[model samples]
Target: MAGGGIGGALGGLIGLACAVLPGPAPIAPVSSVDTSLWSAATLERGRQIAAAGDCAVCHTAPGGQTNAGGFALETPFGTVYSTNLTPDRETGIGTWSYEAFQRAMRKGIARDGSHLYPAFPYTAFAKMSESDMMALYAYLMSQPAVRNSPPRTKLPFPMNQRPLVAGWNWLFHDERAFVPDETRSAQWNRGKYLVDGAGHCGACHTPRNAIGAEKGGFAYLTGGSAEGWDAPSLVGSRAAPVPWTEDTLFDYLRTGFSAEHGVAAGPMGPVVAGLSTLPESDVRAISHYIASLSPRVDPAVSADAAAAHAVRASAAQTLDDEGGRRIFESACAVCHAESGGVGHFGVRPLMGLNTSVALATPDNLLHVLQHGIDRPATAELGYMPGFKDVFDDRQLAELASYIRARYAPGQPAWRDLESASARLRAHAH
Candidate 1:
């Protein structure tokens, strides 16, 4: 009797799992796309949408064809390669019908009805308007197709089961369309839509749970990590010594440099590059929306005054560590020093005002020191040479500690610098 009861309970559990595991039927592939069906305006709009989404940044591999895919994304589960977005019959999405594309973008389901990993950001794309989605589809179909198939994403054990993604979706995915708040201005609404939808800013800036889902409510845009670099918080708790205003944010997003903050680095470098193609108005809207979320600086304290104060604080601690001071003066001060004049990149970034120095962790500062900026946000902004080969673990740690002490006097000192530097170096290799 006991054996029979156990078997019955196991069978019930299996039945429940089977009911939820089935996915949508696969859509038949098309022979060729009819480009004439889409108007020129639609194509242009789609191009803008693609830029906002930074699609090419993720889809294109280094030195590879645009939108042909092969860029590998490292996640907690494993590496997932981006798929080809071009209109190729075999390897790309050329055979995909508009309906199939729509489902994939909004539902995280492929044309063949397989559950796509959320790493594709379909959860965010689902909020985009139908017109915008169609425009993107039209634009992609019009691009030059490359016959390339990216490596299939393979995870260990039970994670290899794509059907399990359905459960993840049920738990975390929100497919509701964006509704503009009537109280807000049109510009603000537009900015919010772009930021939350196509931009998917939270994907990088928001903290995530153990299951890899972004934490919402109080945790939205409270800072996260991407490609091993810290994506600083965009909310009231921003790490930059100076609070960001709409004007500053606009300049940063449009030009990839902010006089009061710092240049875009890490994964943010690609995002800024993409934003450079957008219309000034759209950029302004985005800046406006993001600024609204941040707490305003004291009205009595002017930005210039605040900057001067920070510089003074950093300078006060310059002599605290002789070893670190020597390294900074010898290796970094030429461009970063207040009186160093214009750097090789035409602009000398003050370390005191840099966001990397003020961040809660030394991750961004360490990354910049080790890898440098091979590609500046813009060509004219100039490049930074990495010190990976120049500095050993001890030197790297000392330099980082000195910079933090000098620049961010109020924040707690970063611990375990030597170990952190060693770990980052190993990961880079």
Candidate 2:
């Protein structure tokens, strides 16, 4: 009777677990294909879809094979290693059936019935259309199957338990395809789909709750942290003095640089680099959608905007007795203050107008100062050597304060700069 009672309790526990799950268990794939037999156009479309999602950016490790995974994505919980998407039967998704793949993409369920961590950004992918999902799957399966197994994710204690993720899904996951807004223009709708669904821009751009789940509704895509860099706000409370026009956004997205905004650095650099591969129309659509989110007035006509743009200190004012200015003259003024000339390194520095210095928070400026800007994706853009070794915490603070005051005059002084610099330097590793 005791044994019977124990068995009954075990069965009850299993039932409860199943009930809490997002969906039924995925069936294992029975067959394996050596080659993708998809049409050329379909394959090409799949390639575009994969690029739109920037799949390779996360899946591929630095100097590693494409989609071979093993890239470590750091989260508040811990580090989650990316899974191989190649066609390798053992280490990758080669054995995954269409149903299993669909469930994994839309519902965050793995083929063996394990819960995939949200670091995979499946929440956003859940909004992807069925056709796009299939196309992405095809593109990944067609890649050369690298027989590499990535390290398993190691979360702390209770968080490591995979079953707990079900509760996370129950609270946050939306297992549905994207539904277009019929009232909006096709370009607008397309942008919405790409941003909200396939591109999952909010994964990095949107701030998150305490649980690391992204905050939705009004808090959507305002600003967030990526890796370590603070992703500046994309709305009207944007970092730049001159508001982002669709054309400027398009330029930044397509080429990783805008004359007005300066060059993309840190995490944004790679993202824009990947975006360069996408079609111009798609980038334009994304810009249009993002621009619609904010109520920024055109910088051309707004006198307020013109005044803000003119906030930078004049050359004479740059020589003030403030310790910040003295430091800038000694260290920063050479390359940054020098004007238009020739060749890659000869390109004039974008002070005063740089979006990085103009941001409300000094985090981006701190990031660039600590790590420096390196545009390796395009050698033509040149690079800025990191001054972390050269400047101690106090010096770094003074330098950041100087840049903000001299270049971004209207913006208030960044508070607690010394502590902020110290914190940033601590994480520089």
TM-score, each model?
0.93, 0.88
TM-score of 1: 0.93
Model 2 error, position 389 (Å) = 2.1
Best by the TM-score measure: 1
- Whole-model lDDT per candidate: 0.83, 0.77
Clashes of each: 0, 0
Candidate 2 TM-score, true structure as reference: 0.88
Deviation in Å, model 1, residue 259 alpha carbon: 0.6
Give lDDT: candidate 1, residue 299: 32
Q: State the lDDT of candidate 2 residue by residue for 95-131, as single tens digits.
A: 9887888888898889998889899989999898888
